[model samples]
Every structure is written in structure tokens, then in C-alpha cells.
Target: MALNSKDTAETLILLLNRSGQGDRAAFAALYQATSAKLFGLALRILHRRDLAEEAIQDVYVKIWHHAPSYRADKAAVMTWMTTITRNRCLDLLRSLPPEHGLNEEQSFDEWASDDLGPLEKATSNSEARALLQCMKQLAPLQRQAIALSYFQGMAHEQLARQLVQPIGTVKTWIRRGLQVLRSCMGAL
Candidate 1:
């Protein structure tokens, strides 16, 4: 890893250690340093902005409770944080009914305000930017279907109902979109 990456990891470790001791300022600093990336990850997993926000909030709560158990020898601080966030998102997805669909009228701007600020976008790691670029290469409908299924954890039937498309069509869109994304990402 680069020197800067090492420094960042060390800083996160220090923050985690302080947070484990119940240092509010350190915990706050940790959130400030990591929330944007974690939020983006949650949003990618749970397409609904509201749900993503909730997931990140829950993730931080878990971090607060579990920070003392973190083992740097097992994984880097960011890896541990990401694992927690990802697991939280998966748990949330599993808890929701497969038929649940997001409200179509909820504006993206509302959910993206804090998560995608200028600095956050500018600071996003290259891998995230590349994945986003690959996502952009998808057809509009394909991308929508994929996002609904993967992020929102919607079933094919649910997506069909929300999109006014047949279940088969929704499945096809998701399959093709994912294939394209895989190819694009692999090429990077």
C-alpha cells in the first residue's frame, strides 16, 4: 500500500481505539472520516436512499457497540468497517419482504445530499469511480432494473409491478446489465 494509505489506516485504527474507550470526539471524527464511503456502499446495496441512510445509521451504532472487539491483526480498519456495513445492509435486506418496492416519487436529491457532496464525490476512490462509470454505460431501463433488484432487494415480480414491465423482461434487463457491468469492471 502507498504511504498515504498506510497513514490513513493508522489514523482509523487510532480513532477506533479511542472510540472503543468511549471517546465521543474520536467517534465523531471516525464517522466524519468514513461515513461518506460507507454510505455509498450502503446505497449501492440498498437502492432506496432512505433505506441506505438507515443502514448507515445502524452500521455506526453497531460500530459504536463493537469497536472494542475490532482486531487490526485480522483486517485493516476500513475493511472491518466495510464488513460491518455490508453485513448490516444484507441483514436489512433479508428482513424486508421481497415484494416491497420503493416509492417512485422519492427524489434522489434528498438521499444524496450528505452522501454525495462535492468533496465526497471528489474524494471517492478510483474503484468506486470506475464502477460508477461502468454503471453509466448500461441502458437506462437496464440500470434501473438492476438497481431496484440489487440495491432495493426487490424481487422480479416487485420490479415488474413498479416498472410496469413483465417479470421476464425485468429479469432479462438485470441479467444483461450485470453482465455488462462485470465485463466493464473486469476490463478496468
Candidate 2:
């Protein structure tokens, strides 16, 4: 890993550790460092500025409460934080009715995808390239589910509604899709 990224990662880990010990300043720093990325992820999944904003607020609350339980051995800091945000967004989506699907005025593809041919230069990172490769190999639904959840910070509820599929089905796609990605990447 590059020194800069490694430093950032280490810093995040330290912040998380301090937050777990009830250090408010460290938690504040953690929020400041990660909020923008988390907000963008929430925006992508929720597709509504208001809801995205609300979700981030709720996500931070959860993070504050759950920080003590975070185990770095289980997942990276970003992955853990993203999962919380995605789940909260999905919960919000589930409470809404089916007719509340994507608004025609808000073309998700227009803003959600910047189309740098997928902005997929793979970040000049080997892991990103490997992940992109594994992602492409997925079944369309599976791939979409993973991308929406991991890449776009989508929770399953909105993802199901967006894909026009049942919630259970969408969850299955994400679960199975993750298995494939893990297996494929493990080979690298």
C-alpha cells in the first residue's frame, strides 16, 4: 500500500480505537474525515439529497454507539462504516411504498454514474482492479446488488425497489454476489 493511504488507514483505525474508549474529539475527527465519502455513498443509494443527509446523521449515531464493538480483524474501517450506512438507507427505503420508486426527474444514471466509462480507471490500485475484474464476472443482478451496496452505499430495500425485484431476492443476490467476489479476489 502507498504510504499516504496507509497513513490514512492507520489514522482511521486510531480514531476508531479512541472513539471506542469514549473520546469525543476522536469521534469528531473520525466523522470529519469520513463524512464526505459516506455522504456520497448515501446519496448514491438513497438518490435523494434530504434522505442522504438524514441517513448520514443516523449512521454517525450508530457508529458512535457501535464503535466499541468494531473489530478490525473482521473488516476494514471503511467497509464497516459503509455497511452501517447502507443498512440504514435500506431501512428507510423499506418503509416507503412501492410507488415511491425512482422519480423520473431524478435520473439516477445521470448523476450517480459519471461515465468516465464507469469512472473505472480502477483508481490505479491493484486491489481495485482485481475487485473490478471480479465484479464484471458476476451475474448482472448479483453484480448490480454488490455495486449498489458496496460501491454506491445502497441498502437492500432501495436496491430491490430499483431493480424491481422482491426484497428477499435482492438480498440473496447481494449475499451470493459477495461470496463470488470474495472467492475471486482471494485467488489474487
Candidate 3:
């Protein structure tokens, strides 16, 4: 039967709880339901379909392995799953050498291409706008570093080269930039 958001959430909670208790069917159901959204999240951030798909698969593997450790109160099941998806996407992004091309089927320019419609839902939210405004307040260099590392999925060394700065400076920029962003977001 089709489920409303509330019903879906209840179903998810039940499934996640069962998965946490080592129920494979519940875990499989959770993966089936969340994979598309999780894949979209990774694709937007990684800008590579294959890598994002891989990240989604890897995330499910991890969720299966670590289902028992999930803490429901800390975040909704979707949020927790998205966090795992994001982390795996970032980790894979970091592992690759800079300039590694997405398979020839996809154009490289997609890096700047967002799934804007879906992202707008999140980005236009009050919290996201506040964070964006705070990000705008950073120095150009710091902002670039932050964007490259977080948004473009570049590692520190890659960000350093892209920005034409030393590795130390790149790290400093990212750290300081994040500190500012945290303080700014916190204030809002």
C-alpha cells in the first residue's frame, strides 16, 4: 500500500529498529527504499554518476554492517543514511587522484551541475540559506578551499594545487573557513 510521509516514517522506524536487531529483510527493505535518494545525494556532491552509484552501494554495505550501531535519536534514519552516503562519497572522492575523469559517457562539466531542483529544496531552507550567507562572508581563498574540499569533492592537496597555494595554507584555509562557518551557522 502507498504510505504518506508519516506512515513511511513509522515504517522506516520499525524497519530500522528490526535491522538494528539483525533482521536482514528489514535492512534490505531499508536499502531498497533509500537507495535512490541516497544516490541522488551522492551524485549531486560527487558529480559523477558511476562514483555516486558506487558510493550508494558502498553506503548500503556499510549500513548493513553497522546497522546495530545506528542511534535513532541522533538523526532520522534518512539523515543518518544520507550522512553515511555523504561520508562514503567524500572518502571515495579523496582517494582518487585529481583530474581522474568520469567515464567517457559523462561530460566533465557536470561537476558544476547540481541536481538543482532537488537541492533547492534543501538549499532554500532557512538553515541552508543562513549557511550560504555565512559562506559568502569568507575570504575568497578560504571560501574556495572550503568549496573545493566540501562541494567539489577535492582533497586538501588537490585544493592546494587548484588554488595555487601551499598544502599548509590550504589546510589552514579549510580549518579557519569551517570555524567561521560553524560560528556563523550557530549564530543563525
* RMSD, every candidate, angstroms: 6.4, 4.8, 5.3
Pairs that collide in candidate 1 are 47-151
Query: Could you give the candidate ranking by lDDT, starting with the highest?
Result: 1, 2, 3
State every prediction's TM-score relative to the real structure. Answer: 0.59, 0.70, 0.65
Q: Candidate 3 lDDT, tens digit per residue, 10-40?
A: 7887888898898999988987777767787
> Which order, best to worst by TM-score?
2, 3, 1
Q: In angstroms, how far off is 135's CA in candidate 1?
A: 1.7
Q: Relative to the true structure, how large is the alpha-carbon lDDT of every model?
A: 0.75, 0.75, 0.70
- How many backbone clashes does every candidate have? 1, 0, 0
In angstroms, how far off is 109's CA in candidate 3?
11
List the candidate 3 regions with Cα displacement exceeding 4 Å.
Answer: 1-14, 22-29, 73-79, 94-126, 151-153
Candidate 1 TM-score to native: 0.59
Ten contiguous residues minimizing lDDT sum, candidate 2 = 107-116
lDDT of 2 by residue, 72-141 (tens): 7888888789789888887877677866565765434422332324545524545666677776666766
